[model samples]
Target: MLRQNLQQKLLQKLSPQQIQFIKLLQVPTVALDTRIKEELEENPALEDPSLMTADEPVSEYDDLNERDDYDSEAKEDTSTDEFNVEDYLQDDNTNDYSTSYNNGDDDEEKKETPIAIESTFFESLQEQLDLVPLSDTDFIVGKQIIGSLDDDGYLRRPITSMIDDLAFSQNVIVEEEDVHEMLKVIQSFDPPGIAASDLQECLTLQLKRKDVNNPIIKKAISIVEHHLDEFTRKHYDKLEKSVGLNSEELKEVVAEILRLNPKPGDSNQVTTKQLQIIPDFHISNNDGILILTLNSKNAPELRVSRSYMDMFDHYDKAAQKDKKLKEAVQFVKQKLDSAKWFIDAIKQRQQTLLKTMNAIMHYQYEYFLTADERKMRPMILKDIADKIGMDISTVSRVANSKYVQTEFGTFLLKSFFSEAIQTENGEEVSNKEVKKILEDCIGNEDKRRPLADEKLTEILKERGYNIARRTVAKYREQMNIPVARLRKEL
Candidate 1:
């Protein structure tokens, strides 16, 4: 026999409305319209004011707590395992869900925006295949090879695997030789490096497409084919010794190799990965006084559907006579409650966004005024959260998805927040400033003898940054800059 014990603990859980607010707060201005439209479609009780007509009477309800007396008693009984329709019919149980915040600005004349369409990477390859004259089987194999080419123009899948795939999927019992033949034809496409297995082959293919008789082209192809390891490791001395070239001659060879398209397919592939940034906040320097404004595109005027309210009234009247109509009342109440919470969430989203951003702007006021990385002070999520009296997670949610447009440029809000790096004089600065200096130092250094991490660290120490060599290396790697050897040229 075992004795049972009772456990008591304070547990916190996010309510449905709080969860809704958190999600809405994280949405950027660009996608917020789509999100609102989705809600409008899902819940008939919610609607944009611009869609409402003058003849339809607006929905109005007093405090849900004061109106719904049955709810208070229903909430007290926790013993029931049975389903309760009154649970949905309960008072929204929230006072902050503002019943009226529609500003009516969405009613202005809307204009159509044009969208651009273009052929994708695969479509372009298919169009090019049209020019080739091949039998049905060879064409099918060629199409398979084209489909196998990755966005970087490399055929990563092995011929054996593709042979199996073609046999299984297309019922084409072709050997490895057929696949290789089709692959060779594909490699001869518009992009010289297309269907290349790896970087060496890709570079060599591009080099062979150039003037083969040219001495520089011959050396470049030889280097890529024979000493790719040495080339990538920047073992220039070994290459110079092996290739029998002096400093100037070796430099020309390396330059020729550098001109080849490493990622040939990406050169023509249409992609929206780099979307046109739509900033959620705009910071304007008006006479050196920075002003921050939230994008109005995110703040749409929303209201409960008037006809839905009339429908609810009809249900309320019918429910008095018929018991079945109570379920309909519960449905109406749930939709209306959801619509109200959503509107309130949008309101909270705007307020929280402005509040958090205001705190950040003031925290880094000097940097905003000058648009100078040097002026930026080290800041983190906790810093802004503490200043705004909000949770760190909340600040993180805003920073993760929001973009701010400044006079200098539009930047992701997360980019502004960096860990503090203490300098020699007991002062702290943003690591971005250190990164900028590292960028500048690398930019001006002679490529023939690029500065190493140790040398860069010494330079930072000389500038009173007191950064360690390893830290400098970390920062260098973070900026996508390679080591001194990789950065070096002939």
Candidate 2:
């Protein structure tokens, strides 16, 4: 049955431009340099810096309307006395803009900063691959396997599929044994555990290669290889009975397992090349009060090219207006407009980042100053949006994938924002604070009898938090923590 009913609801949808603006708001100055280069490559009318800033005066568009009528001979005579664009152009200037199109001096000073080398994970892995000696066939197979690895350096593809791919795509009929051999060789590459087919295999491979001597690792490997189901399902008692290990022995094995690097690929990550988060705003202890500074790096100094401005004026003085000249004038204008827009976007990014972070710092002052996660207050995207006078999505973009470095440590921008829960005293508290307390409680609790969410809630209540068991569970999961039973010790 089809039925039509009258319905009225307010709709809030962002336009493409608005979405672009929001995305532009989050990009820092370093990325802006790339964006400028991209724009320059795509838009030819945009003048390069050198041509636009020449010292010699040229006819500009200022007289575009006034000099509409002129005899050809008379105009030619007047042009000799006209400003030569060359006198203004300095030989050292390499700006892409041509002389007639040059805007004044401001654009010259806004040259982009040179980018430094920041080798990524894949690049680093490839460098290691180069040092290993192998036959052409093995090298080819090895690289293909390496390429198939995930960020954690695990072989996500099945051996059978990789074998099939090698045969069909490369037109090389290699045995699965050959592929397996190459796989072993690649696995032996730096970042030891990479290329393993599964978690247990990955861990076992790393542990076997380690220099440490401990009975726990041997037992853990045995348990993982034979009774992985028991380990993963948290069937600790069953593992104890089947493996013939006592409670203390099982605990030691668990600790050893925890000590292993789940993502072995991270071991090779270069600290120097790592991307460090520099906050767009800084909150400092200023004479007993929090003082904020807009990370001035976000605000790039920019100005229009004077030579391009002169070109517009020069084009107007032509005795007989050439169609090419008219088109050139239009082209320069469009580039100027685009350049202006880019400058405006950069400014908007700075303002938006500052506004969003400022609102957050003010909202969570206690958490920032004291370095106590429990001191955090519940804050949703809407809460920040309301405070910063922007849409919720805008606030979300600023918070998403953004980090802030503080006096205590660096934290994800969104980490400070959490939903609220009521305390036993009927007081609203930030869920972040509750999670912190929960973590602290677990950290301090005796492992023999870990506190369940229900008991955790009671503990929180005793400490003045009136939270429910479900809420405690929710916070635990949000913090990526396991349940109390799984967190249990021998």
User: Which candidate comes out best when scored by TM-score?
Assistant: 1
Models, CA RMSD each: 6.0, 8.9
- TM-score of candidate 1 on Cα atoms, chains taken together: 0.85
Candidates' lDDT values, in order? 0.81, 0.70
Q: Can you give the TM-score per candidate against the true fold?
A: 0.85, 0.68
Q: Model 2 has how many clashing residue pairs? A: 37
lDDT of 2 by residue, 370-487 (tens): 8877788888999989887888878887787566767777667877777887866678888777777889988998877888888998998899977678888988897898887788
Cα displacement (Å) at residue 91, model 2 = 24
